[model samples]
Target: MTEHTSIRIRVTGHVQGVGFRAWTQARAEELGLWGWVRNVADGSVEAWVSGPAGAVADLVEALGHGPAAARVAAVETGPADAASDAAGAGFRILR
Candidate 1:
């Protein structure tokens, strides 16, 4: 069977109001991953992603840089439970 992985990411810094959510969606789609990205009340961008382990890793790395308008400070990653598999079939920009 193919390898699968799931994780939660919290990106801090200049992520809000910078098209970060849309950029994340595009990147996840390009990587053929499924997940949801949203802005937290604390001005951080949080995401839960699930896909091939390598793809997820790539997404995480890309997240560190984010969009050109985003000055990413830190990317915090950790394991996420199956309940986080909420995007159903595609990547999404959550409100």
Candidate 2:
């Protein structure tokens, strides 16, 4: 079954202030994902990605590379938080 699912990914390394969030937003939209990406105080980029299984997987793969300007060190993907609705609206950048 191709049901919707949410994946929360925490990207480590030099991922802040280097257009990571914008890149993630663009990639997520390209994959037709529905979620958001934000910068955490812990110096990591966090993303809430939700969509089809394939799309979510693709998003994770993209995060592994990020923008050409980004030097992605690591990307951790797993189930989203219980508070996050798997049936959210669309992909975006959180404040």
Candidate 3:
């Protein structure tokens, strides 16, 4: 069985008010990932993503460019303290 991993990602630049959260939700669900995406107070987009290692990596890579409306400046990733099931059943968009 594939090993599962969890990571926290913070995407900077032009990420707010650009459907970045909704776009991330779609991608995470498509990848069968469990996590939450939200717009940060600092004007960045943050996510706690958990899933198969490969899927997590793919999602991180995709976050680099983000939605067509987003102009991603940078993406920072690190180990997430939360468990894979922390987000529960599926991906979500947190307000």
Candidate 4:
């Protein structure tokens, strides 16, 4: 079986008010991942993603260039706790 991994990603630059969270949720779900994406007070997008290692890596890569409206400048990732809980079975957009 494939090993599961978890990561916390922070995407900077032109990520707010441009459907970044929604886009992230869709992408994560499409990759069969479990996580939550939210807007940060610092004008960046934050997400806690957990799933198959490959899928999680794919999601992180995609975050580098979000929705068409987004102009992503940087994407920072770090290890996340495995017990982090998502809102539902699939990916979710957190307020």
> What TM-score does each of the candidates earn?
0.94, 0.90, 0.94, 0.93
Deviation of model 4 at 18, angstroms: 0.5
Model 2 sits at a Cα RMSD from the real structure of 1.4
lDDT of each: 0.94, 0.86, 0.91, 0.90
In candidate 1, stretches whose alpha carbon ends up further than 4 angstroms from where it belongs are 86-88
lDDT string, candidate 3, 1-95, tens digits: 98889999999999999999999999999999988999989999999999999999999999999999999999999989754457447898888
lDDT of 1 by residue, 8-48 (tens): 99999999999999999999999999989999999999999
Higher-scoring candidate on lDDT, 1 or 2: 1
How far does residue 3 in candidate 4 sit from its true spot (Å)?
A: 1.3
Residue pairs clashing in model 1 are none
In terms of lDDT, model 4 sits at 0.90
* Model 3 weakest lDDT span, ten residues long: 81-90
Top-scoring candidate (lDDT): 1
- Candidate 3's C-alpha runs over 4 A off are none
lDDT of 1 at 74: 100
Give the alpha carbon lDDT tens digit for every residue of 1-95 in model 4: 98888889999999999999989999999999988999999999999998899999999899998999999999999988767855347787889
Q: What is the lDDT of residue 12 in candidate 1?
A: 100
